[model samples]
Target: MRWEDIKRYQVIEALLLWEGKLNARQLMDYFETSRPTAQKYISEYKQLNPTGFEFVSQQRAHIANDDFTPQFIDLEFSSYHALFNTQGEHAVTSLVETLPQVHRNISPQLVRPILQAIRYQLRLDIGYISLSSPEFEDRIIQPHSLVFDGTRYHVRAFCEKNQDYRDFVLSRFSGEFAFEGEATFDEAHDTLWQTDVTLVVCPDHRLTELQKKVIAHDYQMTEQKLELKTRAALLKYLLQHLRLDIYQAAAEQQQIVIDPECRKLLAPYIN
Candidate 1:
């Protein structure tokens, strides 16, 4: 099928699944097309499965049938939200603006084995490189879960070489990983993954009253302070991602500080 026709079919399924009905006016307004064009699209879709919808003259719309089955799209909110972000067919402009990002280069080759290992409790023997070591080394690891720290994906796994749980960046795997065997370590044994740590943050004490207020407003803080909770194993990554790893920069540059007690508690794990 043509790309345009697939998009039209997906929108039709989205409306039917979410709103329980669809009308030509919804299509006309959404696609900015003529009445006959909207009707033609609906007619074309109905021809694929005549039992998918039933017309209601009172409502002037086609209500989805009790046995309606979508062929073009699944009922996932993320998929619907992605379609919604386009703001309808042929929309090119957006009301929102976001910072530019250079997408990471994580390949499906690395992701697939990690997912399979996590699912079946298997071990992986792979070559990995680390910034600290600067060379590829072969090791066995049992992946338990996957994590995305707002920037990139990390596999939370038990490293047989290190004898502990560690977060391995997906992009850092240097070569193909093969399933070694069943995993001997289990997720329940990873204490850090099971624990929660609270990070209390406050506007830098050195900032002026107005500056502190602005910082508080930016973070939606209550009384110039905010407390964030994260998994103990992820506390370091969370701090690094938020640029709160070190509270030693100039007050205006840093903007925030971790509570001294919280910093002390996290000291052993932050490195």
Candidate 2:
């Protein structure tokens, strides 16, 4: 199937799972397709997964089966939010009216060269602004991969200026960038990016028993602890996101604490 068809089918599947029932008209409006095309997709999807949905003649809609299981769409919080936050008839009012978002202007001009450099194994000369430096400076970097840490986009690259592998935030990149011949380093050589680190998180020991229970349940912790593995380079960001970096903070403030062993492993990365 075409990529577009697959995406539309995934949307249909998500709608059925999230809203319980969906009709051809809704699909037509969402995909901006003809009624017949929308109906055809629904029919094709139903035929592909016979037991997933049932046709309701009275409602003229396809309702999810009792034992319906999602295949194309991941039933994750982010996926659900993306599916419902679209600008269309199927858009849903978010439960949280005001959500925090990182404000950064990322230009396609800056991103395109970085992506091309990574794809074609090339180097790039870029102007970047960092927290330590107020002015943008020229830097030669061997681009590797792009990472999204929820709030912003980061390009993991080998910085010639720093003589090390580092993350350059996309938004902080200034001016135009150009390909500067073949790259000296790839993703394989990025030690931090290549290495995996496990983070064991538990409710702050300072919290009361009841508070600990609530924190455990909130994090869906098993046995009062949650273990998550991520790239070593991303450990600091993940810790900061979960408020685990400030171990000395009060239980009500930090809520969770990292295991001492895990903390020791993450020491180099943690600020």
Candidate 3:
């Protein structure tokens, strides 16, 4: 099958896995395929993985099995959010009444070169506007990976100017860039990206028992705490996104706080 067709099949599998169920009409609407084409994709998927889902006549949908496993996509929160946040007829029913969105100023011209550099392991000379500097500076970086931290896109790269690995915000980059020399660094040397840190978060102990319980339920915590594993480089952004950086806020006001033991590890990133 064509690569696009394969991707659509994977999307169907992902929708079923995350949303628990989906109908043919939803698939048709999302992929802009005809009814027969949608059915064909479903039929082919079912034939390949019989145990993945079961048809429910009452709901007129295919419900994912309890042991359903994703075939082509990683079960990442980003993937889940991307599928639901898309503006389309088959957008998944969201738990929240309204989804928050960030208006980014990223340009396709800037992103395309970064992606190409990453793919080819090349260096890029980019004009970047950093908060620390008042003016945009020309810097050479070896692009490695792209990340979306729920708000903006970031490119993790080895900066020749700083002599360290840093995240360059995609939108903050000026549209002027050129291909430099070959890349000197690889993903293996990125210590922050290679290290896995577990963030232990729990409802603030200052809150009442009832309030703590509510917070735990909202975060789907186990044993009153939630353990999230993330790259050390990305921990700072994650904490900021979850509003856990405001350590001075009252328990009731913040609702959640990081475990004292994990705070020391996150200090460098948080600061």
Candidate 4:
């Protein structure tokens, strides 16, 4: 099936799972398609998951089956919020554009089980690889949350072998996953993830006064600085996203850096 067709079909699956019902008219309004075309979307989805939904004559709609299982789309809520997931949301089809993204082929099979582990506080035995270990290394983790570090999907989990919480990239996982009963660590035990930190950003002082003013305005700064808060563990990702690395570019070109006072306080976390 074409990518566009799959996107349309996933929309049906999302509504059926989340809203508990699917009807041709509702699909018509959502996709701006005719009755027959909307029916075609439902038909195509039904073909993929035959027993996913059933018609409710009283409501004149296809009600989601109690055992409704998704054959397409990652049902994890984070998939909906990710900037690059684009599971069901179609992006601008015209002139508006964005930089090409790295395609992270994260399988729903990997995601669903991780989400289940997080929800139930269970441990998972997984085969994963990292830059240091090019081969898949068997490891056990107790995942607490799903994180999007601007580009890739990561599961923030407690690594049993490492004896610390770490972000494991979803695409790096391989082989089959096995649930390992209960997890000793959960979100509450992740001190860094539980704590919050503030970032104070300001335009480079070396820039001309006018340039500094423009930069401040661009970042919606007040009092010549932008103050923002985020999870302590996510500080590095936020810095990378804002391009605030002081050594990356010339002061004038970089435009912004964390305020010296805040930088001193946040140095340990960023490192």
TM-score to true structure, per model: 0.68, 0.85, 0.73, 0.67
lDDT of 2 by residue, 129-204 (tens): 9889979988999988998876788889999988999888889988577778999899899988888988999988
Q: How accurate locally is residue 249 in candidate 4, as Cα lDDT from 0 to 100?
A: 53
- lDDT value, residue 33 of candidate 1: 89
Off by over 4 Å in 3: 1-100
Query: Candidate 1, TM-score vs. the true structure?
Result: 0.68
Per-residue lDDT for 20-125 in model 3, tens only?
A: 9978887777778799988988998888788989999998999999999887678875665555556344544344244456778877887889999999999999
Number of clashes found in candidate 3: 0
Residue 168 in candidate 2 has what lDDT?
87
Q: Estimate, for each residue in 146-181, the C-alpha lDDT of model 1 and write its tens digit.
A: 998988889999999989998898888865777888
lDDT of 4: 0.82
Give stretches of model 1 more than 4 Å off.
Answer: 1-92
Candidate 2: segments with Cα more than 4 A from true spot: 32-38, 56-61, 88-103, 247-250
Best by lDDT: 1
Task: For candidate 1, give the lDDT of residue 139.
Answer: 76
Residue pairs in clash, model 1:
none
Clashes of 4: 0
For each candidate, what is the lDDT?
A: 0.85, 0.83, 0.84, 0.82
Model 4 Cα lDDT, one tens digit per residue, 194-245: 8999999998877888999999998889988999899998888888888764
